[model samples]
Target chain A: MTYYNIDFSLLDKTIKNFRIKPQKILLQFPDGLLGSPLQSVVNFLIERDIEPVLSADPSYGACDLPLNQAKMMGIDHIFHFGHSTFAFPPPSEFKGKISYFPVKVNIEFSWNKILEEIIILGWKTVGLLTTIQHVDKYKFENETINNSNITFVQHKEGQILGCNQDRATKIASSVDGFLVIAGGDFHASPIVVATNRPTLRYDPFNETFKLFDEQFRNKYLSKRYALIEKAKKATNWGVILSAKSGQFPKDKGSRILNMLKRKGLTAIPFIMHNVNLPHLSNFETIDAWIITLCPRLATDDYIRIKKPILTSRELAVVLGDLSWDQFITPKTGEHLLTIEEFE
Target chain B: MTYYNIDFSLLDKTIKNFRIKPQKILLQFPDGLLGSPLQSVVNFLIERDIEPVLSADPSYGACDLPLNQAKMMGIDHIFHFGHSTFAFPPPSEFKGKISYFPVKVNIEFSWNKILEEIIILGWKTVGLLTTIQHVDKYKFENETINNSNITFVQHKEGQILGCNQDRATKIASSVDGFLVIAGGDFHASPIVVATNRPTLRYDPFNETFKLFDEQFRNKYLSKRYALIEKAKKATNWGVILSAKSGQFPKDKGSRILNMLKRKGLTAIPFIMHNVNLPHLSNFETIDAWIITLCPRLATDDYIRIKKPILTSRELAVVLGDLSWDQFITPKTGEHLLTIEEFE
Candidate 1:
């Protein structure tokens, strides 16, 4: 029985195709997909004589896999829904254990408004981008538009993550503008800032298209610059390093800590699984914070935190290691450090 | 250098006395002690040529150690402050790595008011109990009172956890009533319920003494009984198994899942590092929840959760495997499963 338009038959087929039998499997879902028929999935597994356990933690993306917890509980196989495989190598121990199932949303999309808006902009060639949920829709619409071109980054066609905008950047030189079919400006704004080109975002949920222009990019950079200025006055800093599967980079954290110490600033490294506002506020003596985990914690959650929180790249700007222009400018190819820098 | 009355010299001496010089150590503090001098501690470690890392996750007690995270970061030493060592044994992998610092509060207490109240109550013999922060005060007051007696449970003198009340229960036959010198009723209420005796809690922060009587016990149990009745009608259950250092019990969780299945109820085991309202609300299909982690989650956080949540013992009552009287009665000595069952 399918609920919330999630196709369970695909999951069943995928499990049946596996070579070894999975007696116990861990199920992970993003917050948006939690309303799906969970009991039905539990019953289905029970009928097959397989035990299913749900991960009751906030799963941000494919990078936030609870592999350690799964390993501790002896759950070798994991089925992560709502996102595809992240563009990063898994830890050595959890290489083949994780299976990503991009829960594709089979919903109707009205492309008339976005297409007209794109045509009105007088763009000859346009790059198409979307998230995993709307990749099938993106593919179907890719064939109908003659000016549209879609590129594959890693696994899916025309899919881009919040941190990785390679699909839009790879075809930036060829396309005049870009059209992103996704939920909101969260995915589209990065493309606009990275490519420095006109980008139109079609929110399938709200059925509206909005353009991210040069004005939006300037505002985003100005906010980041203000935070960097605030961080310069901080004498003590808390460097937040994530404990998620792919987010934890101990070496990078150590380098940042060493840099801050050289500048005569008291820096403390914090290892956390969830970096929420409450957890950050616990360090009362920390004048500022430098989050080495998700870049969105600096960009999106800045207002929620009282102290000035900056990303690693932004911290580089504060320490005179990098210029503001170089920090915002888009780079070519899938760089190894860009995954952590952007995220 | 001293902030919030935390003695740093003790920590310094303890580190210097260790035979193995630690190059890197993880520092963990509970939320109540986060406001203490953190940068001073960081500076102290830096002066010794050692790197210090702070754990930003919510630390509930000594049981909430981040051993796995520390191991992953290659930090072999951990100094857990604000609470003493937990009674449970550490995981085999992290046997000798953890060190506990009680962070004793050096605040003055006016025990005259509490002593007068106890005298008016006409209790000839009294058993003393307090937490790590107030254990020194408990010992000092024990020497002055003619009828006061203190008992040791595992580590500290006159220490009682929210889940474990053995300090009071061990000397229950010798004392007419119990006097707990702590901040709040969190550590005192369990003693009142477990022993079913007259208990007085002295809030050192406010310097007030309040007695927990039969009326208070009845009110607490009535609320729990209401939730258990509400949970009996639930067809779908979310069994939460914690991933904290000492809270994770996979065997007990499996037994609960099996019992639920035998009773024809759909039960899904949830493995969580932090069990909060937002995380529990993500499972929309679950009609009720059974948390096998901390007992306080069911008692303290029930009002915040919309659905009924029962502890393992309460779940036992719902399943008719345990009577309500047996669930509340105090057991003798240190039982193997009592730690898990109470927590």
Candidate 2:
């Protein structure tokens, strides 16, 4: 058996030069990292006669809590993993060292589940959301909510990427909830909730934690229609809108255009420099029209229409390409839909 | 009084089109950045179309922290001021649309201050420390310490441009404190505190926060020595050495050779792979040696003699010719030190 058991003698000597006592060492980590790499690091240090300590973050998962932990533990050195957004203190004759490594990870979490859960919890109208990290993943989540009573909307919040909930709900006409799909709490769930729109969030990294599922979604929708009747007296019909990057088909503007054509209605995508609806002709007066969001204007412009409009991002489902629950259900809420009485 | 204003009616009109309701944007800031370009930005935004929300970090005093104020009034956006080391979570939409503005203030904050503070607490002897950020600043801080009672020793860990305190502390022996003069919390404080050293912090931006003055620093030091004393035990010195690249003297190798000449010591700085301390006769049983640190070594052989040594970055201080610190220290601790510290 010609075993490839080469030699670690040189490695041993080399490591000895870098050797440290079994002093406690701490490491900080960011979210979206796997557990395997951490284990490998631990093993690597132990092989060099060093002790390794680890700690995890609450939301971002495992931030450099381990690094702080190592310092507290009197560790001679620490190796941290995560986002590279802070400075690591240098060593002093009296203190140890802290190092950083921004390790990447796989496995993106879904947010459609979170929307389903909201619907189950008795929420009807919803504004779709995502962040820079998960913005690219919106397509996968959008596919799930293709055709359903649930209306999902996406908005392009350039500098206002997160926490444009007030704008979302106000423009959404009659928003019942917000299904946020993204990273940590920075994406702004409370802002939307503050506008009387309950919020359900699904972190792109952690999946086990969900909002709600389908069975619960339908039950809530049955009750939501009546609520909508009351809201319609004051507001109007609710719609699903998505306004992400064009490169990301998550907005599905072209698809929505196709859907409106099939519905015997003309859906026009207008990128206007000036706001003049006079040229719209019959577009100004229709059964129900959507501004096929192409970023010609902000959400404020859409509200002026004062009519029911489906979000380009969510029109795919209304077009009936996707199965009835394309949306993910993470938390339990009133934002679900029931197809029992759908036409 | 006459003020020159540069504005156009058309530009203002364009901005109004992008306007939503008033927004109170909050930001997290560090100390040194208190007087940085952030204030300029705040003024700029205020003059523009947006309302500004400000907050300072209490930990590093980077920025203002008006959480309660922002929450009570319901802020719309938050622009955080910090280093580029993180994808720092913006205030949640639940909170607001939080953004980031990297503050350019450099001062090795973490380990440097921790080491210095511990020494000032109760330390009789401590080896001064340095990292890439302010390795050159070691000289400035050392000059401030003067060779008086505090022994500002220099040491090196690796080729890393940033500071690594854990790696630094591993080599520090019998040190009561290791004063690091860097910026931010992660720079030196983490490493020093991990070794149980009572650390002291000196933020270049301290004045921006209206926090401490020089008098406070002086008072803090006397007390700091006591703190360091309670933190650890002390040890007698062993090797007192120096390197050719000690403290990056403008004269480089000449300085170390000169110092050795003055001491009548046959200490030959090995710029090459020769670390063999010629067991020559008659050298004072050294107290603690200096391991000169070279900026970008020609070869990795200088660190061959890992015995307690001072780095060239540190030696640049002992000899009092270090000029690069002006850039490094200011850049180390600022929330976002965008410009290179060592211009």
Candidate 3:
């Protein structure tokens, strides 16, 4: 029942600094972090006589803001929990009302052990990148690395979202490797595969750091290549037009459909609010799928839907608009070319 | 996989008659019917090159239109399946866009058995009311009752929604008994209790008919009285402001809060898109709940939430604005007194 730490002082500071006196506020927390702390937050707001509306819908990451629901309820402000602010801009309508309160996760591990491992891996300079949670704590300036041989450089962006790893990729040439101070390989593996940069993932929950290097990248790339190959031969494609707040690019499906049509492939756009294995099974005629959802979904090849699901970028690579090399290792500050580019 | 009958001819007739040449259509089916038939319906529309967006949310009945989702996608029309037309008009904005195609469930029960049962029960004139499924098939004129001892009367409204049984209540005095030609007492018991008339429930699923008379009515009334009595003693109330497409009366929650404040009750409104057992458990201060979602939810006492749940009408009864008698038998062609009326 240990709840993740919410920086109340930071939240209060932000509200005061912004001069926000909210009447009706919408609160959105990632599905995993919604529990006692969420209830306490609601009760706290209620005690202050401020109306708080809790969004019960699933929120995957910071990229998926519940702006539509907030607008419908005519909420004055939104407090998004459990993720960093998106590197990319949100829909223009959500300008002043939204606030990000990424909950900080406490990681209790020996930095000495991490430093020793870094030296053993023969890394002299490392780019420091972490999920939003540990960003405030892991300032490279405070880290007492006694060895003059080691240099730790903080990314210009401060933190990295799984979908937006510009900072890590940008300094890949300057640093020997990137160290991710987040839980799990979910954020780490993608950076390694996308940028071909060696990355180390630190799991706070288990107090372990795993190296995602050549082996992981090769596996991910080979599988992605196989999926692209399968999709290249696909006569019929089902373009996933998710209705979820984060994943849905409103006109992306139509653009993909037109592109597929031009290539002499029959493509049908399937609008789904929540995609599940059985639900996708309904479209029996579809040979392959191009998911226009979370860019991260493309890397999640473990989801056994029995169909080759590719990201829009992968689709472009298979269709020859871009090579696999160009699709991966996107130039620093260059945003991932979503199907929106075609439009 | 067999899908219950979808009257395509009737659908085509309605479309042609209405001159609705929809380029993009939204299709919504009740949660139970969202399988093969839903797929077939989508494929059929796709064959005509009419873009179909299948709503993957829980649709309780015709009242739960996916109008919001439809409007978001800019769909030209919505075809709601598995429920009859809503007894009440939708919000004015959704006037032309939404249509209900209540799928007919073919019941193979013999009408002769029903006629004999009515005669044996000592009823001379009986009003025939049914669900959307059996409405078209059960023709009152075609029922050959040679006995001349019984007369079956069909109300002008013809069908009754489980939530709104105005038609049955309207002609209650005109008939000795009411015969509901549907599967369950979900549509029958309320009618019987409301009208104080003996009603027979014909279960098409099991091909059995059961009489719901004084005993059943008294039992339902007692439980309702007990709930009202419990709510009367409760100091704190949580008015469930549901965000579902159908059940969310947008302005209803604030109005209820005002009403409760006027009555000097400590009431807090909780807005939820979906209410679950655990979510309801969070509001520890609230002693009782007034749910505005699906009218049927108020009657589902079996839900393990361990709190007295009341419908708006029952709330009115407890608060002395309306008597139980008036609450039970609503006037003919009149809608139920939803919580919206208090606004």
Candidate 4:
């Protein structure tokens, strides 16, 4: 029943602890956990006479909670698995009904291989960063490496969100480099860019290590720079915004819209739940597009999109407000409205 | 500038007649009109110093308006082209700012070919049905056919919605068959099933005719029947509901949810803006799915969907409250809650 080493004991205990028995409960999971033994979870609830519903939508992170949709169906309790709670507060309408279950993947850590890579790179000190799923393994690896000369700077949770890399930023100054204990470079890229430090991603599932060094960062930034140059010529820009729980950029969309208009450029704001290429392609008038939701869409999904698309941060660079270096390695307090000051 | 023969002089007049000029306007179009000279529309607006934003989302009908999203961006006025006003009223928050411009497509009607087909079918009287785009052409075609004994039953406005076939049902008793002047069988299928009449679709765009007779209906019904049989084995059903302007099923979703529970079946309500197979595939616990939004997703897009999916009407048949015949050829007042009567 415990496929992918996801412990549902905590989930079962939490449900039992609820003051009132929920007639219906919504079960949400990230794409990775979708193929897990979900029927087991459903069967567990059904045994207790609780009706369980699965949220089939693509859940990106802890930020993408289907609470609003759950509320509409009168289902109060939602078990969002695979990620921890996000930094942002849920909208007032959807408060306190969500339970975040960071389902842990029990994988054997390739500590020797990681240590060998660190020694080969000649790193004296390293910062240990990981996602919620591998946090326990991260702590164990840190303790095991205590005998070595290489110092491991550990943050409170050792977690890094695709959007928020504050944890890595906090410990960046103290560590020589970062060793991200996660599946892919997706979690490590932000750390490398934001901290401007060498980061290595260790995939315990495959026991492989990929380094995100200066060369990798330069290559990534060059692609982004080319996109900014392409976006610079755009006079009529479509600002894509999402209304999702985590992805929604409150007043940032309007501020961007107002800034563009003041610069004598035409800007139209498009709002949707999930922004895809096919939907954005419908706007033929839009010379370029700026995505306000999920920065990855601007960075990672740029190639697939036909039109020149830039991130809100990249827009600042195009508007001549932020330098290319400043845009890539964003400092504290720098945001989408930094362009407004240039106005 | 007038690709697809869509006249925009009326759209121009409508904009000029506005009491105040809208600084930013949202242009929404159905899929057919998305590729048609949109830049001309954009240039025309730009010439008037108006900022035009094209809605890139797939607009199924006038009902799929992005007004809420428009209002969120402080865009008050929206020019929804290519379809007439839907039967349902806009949400209370978005009551007034919409201007529905049913852009007419001027196409040379193959009257001789249509007459020959009708004569071959041996139809003495036929009900005329056309969408708003071809309503003007429909009027001319009706007048020309008046010389023959094959009387054409004309309604107030020869328009048909995929969801609502009340117009076709209105003249069903008077006419022997229906001549739908449109492109595909998508618009014609509903009329054929609902009215139990032979419906012929004349694609003015291609000048081709396709007749949806008893054989066609039987073929369509058999597929649905097979799905119903497959769905009958499913204990956990995921009921898909959309929150799009026109497609939102409102209270019908909840009604179906309650009906499913009353019959001792586990039903999960999935509320999404755009429901697709990939997103729905994530729910491994869902044995089958019921689409409460667009009925076409169940009827037409069934093959694309992997699991057994049913419409709200079909759900009644699976529960044994409504017969398969009653489910397909639904009479007045037969609805999603018709199953509740048996409960």
* 1 or 4, greater by TM-score: 1
What is every candidate's C-alpha DockQ against the true complex, given to 2 decimals? 0.61, 0.02, 0.20, 0.36
lDDT of 1 at A241: 88
- Runs of candidate 1 exceeding 4 Å displacement: A1-13, A116-126, A140-156, A172-177, A209-211, A262-264, A330-343, B1-19, B119-126, B140-156, B171-177, B209-211, B325-343
Residue-wise lDDT of candidate 3 within A69-182, one digit each (tens)? 666677888888887776564443444467788786665556777788888889998888877777777654545565446888876644877666777767777888888877
Q: Per-residue CA lDDT of candidate 3, range B1-343, in tens?
A: 2238987887677667656677888888775566566767777787777887767555667776766566566788888888867766456344446788878775565777888798798999899888877778765456475445677777784687766676786788889989897876778877776677899988877779989998987888788888888888887777776655566766766766667768887666555555554556555556788776665667754255667888776777768787766766666544342323222
Query: Which has the greatest DockQ?
Result: 1
Using all chains and alpha carbons, the TM-scores for the candidates as numbered come to: 0.88, 0.24, 0.75, 0.85
| Candidate scoring better on TM-score of 1 and 2 | 1
Give the number of the best model, judged by TM-score.
Answer: 1
Which tens-of-lDDT digit does each residue in A124-184 have in candidate 1? Answer: 6778788888777644434445454332222237788887677777777777888888887
Candidate 3's TM-score? 0.75
Q: Residue A175 in model 3: shift from native, Å?
A: 6.5
Listed for each candidate, the true contacts retained, as a fraction, are 0.85, 0.00, 0.15, 0.37
Candidate 2 lDDT over residue span A72-170, tens digit each:
234565454543323323222225544444343344454456645665778666766654333444563455566556765655531123312333434
Docking class of 2: incorrect
All candidates in order of lDDT, best leading = 1, 4, 3, 2
At residue A17, give the lDDT of candidate 4: 91
**lDDT of model number 2:** 0.37
**Native-referenced DockQ of model 1:** 0.61
